[model samples]
Target: MRQVESEEFERLLTDFEREAVHLETRDAYGTAVELPHMAKWAAGEPDDLSWLQGWCETLREHGRAGRSVRRARIVSEPLSDYQRWSHSIAHPMVDAGEDIRWVPRRLVSGVGIPGNDFYLFDDRTAVFLHYAGSGLSVGMTATEDPRAIGLCRTAFEAVWGLATPHRDYRPV
Candidate 1:
């Protein structure tokens, strides 16, 4: 797996021709970018989702370009604070033309989920996210290994099939 910078990862999203799929396996992601938003969410402050405007625009642009974006999040029952926040804030993505789904971890009994979260582009390239134990993102690795790409595609599809749409999934 070749390590890639975050900018390169973003470029893959922009460059993909068909679709981009994301598999999120973690219950919490303690990234610097999310910390403040999470804090506000935890405090019950009304979220001003203007921060998502840029990402929403990106998704919109992709949609306009005939590309699809999808995400499947594997979450545990009795959702973590971060997960709840994530679920609550997903409407912007939906409005921007991205499809998001949530699969309860218990439902994935025999599914072979990868150790790290990943983004698969056009079913060809896979970018795996490495995170510290504290849930902080450390780095990313991108590869076109058929084995890796196939694994991610299979796992993501499995979860996507079983997951509930964001509108129907209520966080605990």
Candidate 2:
């Protein structure tokens, strides 16, 4: 196992060759970069979401390069404020070529989820995202072990199968 730096993980966003699949099991998050934006949302202030453009551009690049990016979010229903806000802002990413799907936690009750959210890169590397109880990110640990890779791939696929595409999700 390797401890992955945030920068290195960001690079993998554009470095992977075939596909990148991410599974998010959190209902709320306190990512430093996103907190202020979410605050604006909660305050009824408008945000241009310009901060998201770089990521959107990256997604577009992946599309042009024939690399695919997909994310499955397993969220609690009667959605948390963060997720409700997330649903409202997902259009740009989806439009930029990411396949984002949402599945209610209820739907995944019978599935075995990984201990943390993770990104599986090309089915070879798995980067597990660790977070604090307050929803702040702690760190990410990555592994190339086949068991870990298989676990992420399997879990993500199981949730993906039960998720609704971004456009179709109504976020109850």
Candidate 3:
């Protein structure tokens, strides 16, 4: 049986703890977030995913502020009207300096829904998971690990460069 080294296991646990904090503290606005693999796993479909609710609330909170939380993504499936309605209500709050960021999604990436899973965060972090179904995870954290953050930042920059910004965006 393959066994993890004691030190390595400890480090992994520590990293998980750090990651939890890192993910929670940051203003999490993403294009294709792994909702299924959220920090919490409830029975069946997560009807009341606190993280998702928090995500929405965080965006809305940022929307109230002047700084908009932007997002870029290549859409795969169409969103429901209710989803559109919720976003539409939250998006404007950012523009109005209410406490939300106008997160935008770019449908330019040439990948299908199941094959394409990527997350980018404000040019600071990027994570690409499930490249070959083995599922990979990479991202930066505001922890003491400078090198880790640097690696994630590099990946984010690469994807950001290839992505297109929101259509309504007008550079300030």
Candidate 4:
């Protein structure tokens, strides 16, 4: 890979922050599959292969750069088969001593309803609506009040703290 200058990297980050989008997607296994598939494509790898290799490449790159990558907290209503499969692929970051978190439906309490499957990046700027066996759609605007994001993060922490590793995971 060509080395990116500091200014170029900063510019890239700025652009990502300014135009970042988020999605509110369906809770489906295909959504999970897409995450890794995109990763592989980004690394010029065969899209058919599991993003397992790309994920490791990312970790190594971050490690070499002394950067830290945080895992996401998935907040969903009732746990579904797709969520379970998603966890299987996403948990490796945590297992490798990188920071990854999750909150599944089975562990949540005092929650009125489940939040939509959404992606929050650039600190909740862009969210994409992911679906199974179809194209992705745009998610609604995440409220400016970071509180919603905070709440979701908090709930994820709560569930993540009590949830088992994928290796030990059983159906939700």
Per-residue CA lDDT of model 3 for 1-172, tens digit only, reads 1233436433432233112111111122332444343322323343343434545654444444433433333222343332233333343323433222222234324322222233333433333332222233333222234454455445334444454433343222
Q: How much RMSD separates candidate 3 from the native structure?
A: 11.2
TM-score of each: 0.97, 0.98, 0.30, 0.46
lDDT of 2: 0.95
Best by TM-score: 2
If ranked by lDDT, best first, what sequence of candidates would result? 2, 1, 4, 3
Ranking by TM-score: 2, 1, 4, 3
RMSD of each candidate relative to the true structure: 0.9, 0.6, 11.2, 9.0
Give the better candidate number (2 or 4) by lDDT.
2
Tens digits of per-residue lDDT for model 4 on 62-163? 555555544444446555555644555555555544555554544556543225443334454322233335434332333434766555445444555655
lDDT score at residue 78, model 1, on the 0-100 scale: 96
For model 3, the run of ten residues with the poorest summed lDDT: 17-26
lDDT of 4 at 19: 25
Q: Residue-wise lDDT of candidate 1 within 120-162, one digit each (tens)?
A: 9988899999999899989999899999988999999999999
Clashes of each: 0, 0, 16, 9
In candidate 2, the residue pairs with backbone N, CA or C atoms under 3 Å apart (3 or more residues apart, or in different chains) clash, namely: none
